[model samples]
Target chain A: MIKTMKALIQREFWEHRGAFIKAPKIIGIVLLVTTLIAYITIRVTSAKVNGEAILQSGILELKDMSLENLILFWDGMFIGTSTLYFMVLFFVMYFFMLGSLYDDRKDGSILFWKSLPVSDAETVISKILTAILFVPIVYSLIYFVVLILLMIFYSIILLFHGLNPIELVWSPAQFIKGTLVMFSGTLIQAMWALPIYGWLMFCSAWFKKRPFIYSVIIPAIIAFSWYWFKVLTSLQFTNISVFKSPAVYLGHAMFPYSNDYMGFSGIQFNDDSEAQLSEILANLFASVQRMEILYGIIFAGILFSVSIWVRRYRNTT
Target chain B: MTQMITANNLSKSYGKFEALKNINLSIGKGKIVGLIGPNGAGKTTLLKAMLGLTKYTGDLEVMGVNPFKDRAKLMEDICFIADVAVLPKWISVDQVLDFVEQTHPKFSREKAEKFLKKTKLGKKQKVKEMSKGMIVQLHLSIVMAIEAKILVLDEPTLGLDIIYRKDFYDNLLNDYFDHERTIVITTHQVEEVEHILTDLLFIKDGEIVLDSDMEELTNQYFEVMVSNDNYDDAISFKPLSTRKIFGKHVMLFKNVNRGELEALGDVQRPGVADLFVALLREEEQS
Candidate 1:
């Protein structure tokens, strides 16, 4: 089984190299240019306006830091870079998932895969693993390197102008920490959106119609139906019990609010400067544990099962 | 000999319609079997059912395991290539070869490389960039590399030109097939496959109407040509069918004496295509 799976993974990687590897390089060029532009923008604007007052108010404090400032800086750099990268990232990854996989079925490429010694389950899971794990990790590393180069250029500009060196200088440890956080958070985002991946695979297997449209429309119909069914059930039964359940209502939105609500407790009202790092780590761990990861797993498993079943029994002729 | 495939009282239905009704067959190893049938005659469904790609009731086995329930285990010995070509389009030929080499225990990448080099397709060409015939050749090369016991090919040469089709079958016979391998090919091109087929199966509306070894079928049957004056005398032989020619009668009979057949005018062997058409015509009449 291990040997077979190894071969299967190799096959998946081979088939996706064009989309996964070559396409990323093209996008990386765009990312590099954009990062350069942003770096130059900050340098030119700062030189023109001489925003030295803003830099030297101890506001760029390296020794003394506030949580709000840290978050602001982190969100500013990370989210801005991440959003641009992900736009290219998801397309590079998901396009192959769409074209190589779903297009193969439509164009009779499934015959080649199905004719081999591999099973349907092995084939579909390899696709999911490629989309979620392999593609993102490699692309993120490339993006990280480009970001580092851009930061150095930004720092050079500041040093050339004889501004305060404290704000411009970067700790390598901080860079490493920020990259690690980006990698972990992006993976979490992928995890949260697994149902979408599974849904795509299932759509590939199940429909002969335009797969892209079905991929979007089918999910919308299902969610709408569920919502309407809940509404009708609540009206007819008069108990309103299902709607009253926090788990049922809370799960629908894009991001979970439970963690934010936990962070806003009464003790947080009194802002204490000396809260222990260990305590903060404990809260973060608790939040990670509470994340509804299992629901994603179960959703993925269900969709995977359906996709496998369909591929196995479908009338190819 | 152990039976490699057995379908007993098997039936398949789609919605309100019956696609295959009560099929019973037992096929074993060491013979090349030809599955010939008209359009919508359930040839593909039977193959799918045997591979567990389609659901059916009753018993069916390939290499002592039920094909539907034990598909993964059965796949170790059996390989199926459906009518349509299904190669992943993004990969190069070299990558595809490497992938197949790693996945299948019995795959020989060296053999595949040799075969590929002989063909017009090259290692650098992607599947999407290649022509349909080249794609078929590539698919055939990869499948031929896998040393499987039971090879089920459904319309393997469907879209190829005449030369490629002939070459496809010739290569299949020469390089890939032997006594250790059992090949069951489902095709409408019966005349091309007639030379190599050891056994013949005729399916009509999802049921096996004729299943027999080639030697027995040939020996049991003869097509006799008789003069117009002796047409009624030829009628006494109870032939399968008779067609009127230019001032003569050509008739097909089963289990008739050689001398009696010769006493007419001339007795000749009917090609597999003729026999298949006659049998299908017989079904339509009934």
Candidate 2:
């Protein structure tokens, strides 16, 4: 079973290299180039306005900032970068899961795959694994590489202005800790989004046409109908909408930084405060309820099993 | 002889349309069987049932296992090329080799590579880059490399040129077929596979119309050409079908003695294609 699963996963990688690997790498390159352009623009603008004095004052301010404020600034930066990266990752994963099984049947390649010794369950599970686990890991790795490049680029800019590269950029940035946080956060996000992935996969396997509409719009219609029903009948089935659970959990789980740094651009930190690394970790873990996690797993299991069953019996004619 | 497939009262329906109705068949090992039929004749549906690609009613078994319940285990010893174009177009030739090697316990990468060495297909070339003939060649190379007991082909050479079609059968007979393996093939061009098939099955409208060995089929069914005067006399023997050709009446009779039919103008074994058309004509008339 393990051997077959390994091959199946490898097959997914072969088919979706563009979505899983190339797209992330390209996103990384784009982010790096954007950072370089921004840095050069800042340098030119600073040079026009008494560059030496501005550089000295910036370094002096960095040195005077409290440790809590420094950590908050770096946390906000990490969160900001990841927000952009995850937005792209979300679309990549959504379209990929929606099309993974449908495309095989569309192109008549499912017959070839089914002719092998692998079972339908194995094939479907392998795709689910690829969508939920493999893609996030690949995206995280690219994000890590981009983060390192950005730090290096910033260090170069600091060195040009006679500032200590390690002290100004590397040490205060908390590179190692920030990367660990990103990896862990991605895994948590995958867990929170399992039901959404499962729904998309089921749509992919079951729908004959327009799987995107079936995966998204069907749920939207259901949620809207339930809301209308509740309004008219005055009966509350449940407060939570199944279609919006993942988004709700995701909004709550992301940005483990302190509440004071909630805004996207602005960073405000108290001068006398200390870095609350443990507290931030606690808050991140606490965001997801134990019961919600249990229900999500159950929902995912049911949808995935249905997806496998659909793949097994649905004829590709 | 071991029966590679057994279908007893196996039926399949799509909504109100019956795709296969009460199919009963036993295909033995080492025989190249040709399943011939017209469109919507349940040939592909039967193949799909045998390959466990669809659900069916009644008892059906392939290689002594319930194919629908144990498709993965059955596929370990069975291989099929449903069409020449079923391979994913995005995968490169080398990736195909690697994937099959990893998934199929019976697949031999070395043998597949050996077969590929004779072709112009490059290892790095994706299937989309190859011509239709090359793609068929590549698929054949992969299929032949697997050590399987039963091999099924459903129009495996469809959309290919005549040269490629002939080459496909030639390679199948020369490089793949042996006494240890059984082949079941379905094709529209009956004449092309007639020479290779040891057994013949004719299906019409979701039922088996004719099933016989090649030698037995020839012995049982004979066509006779009668002149204008002898046509009335020949019609007394009740030929299954008759058609006029060059001002002579050509009639196909099933299970009629050759000695009896020899009194006509000319008597000979009917070609498989002609036999198929005659059989379907008989079905429609009946």
lDDT, candidate 1, A158-204, per-residue tens? 56656443454463224654565446544654665565566677777
Please, what are the lDDT tens digits per residue for candidate 2 over residues B75-120?
A: 9999999988799999999999998998999999999999999889
> How much lDDT does each candidate structure score?
0.70, 0.81
In model 1, how large is the Cα lDDT of residue B183? 92
What would the TM-score be for candidate 1 when compared with the true structure? 0.81
The residue-by-residue lDDT of candidate 2 on A63-131, one tens digit each, is 556666767666657767776666677678778889877998998988999899988888888888887
Specify the poorest-scoring 10-residue window by lDDT in model 2 chain B: B277-286
- Which residue pairs in candidate 1 have backbone atoms (N, alpha carbon, C) closer than 3 angstroms, thus clashing? A108-B86, A109-B86, A109-B87, A111-B86, A112-B86
Write down the worst ten-residue block by lDDT for model 2 chain A: A258-267
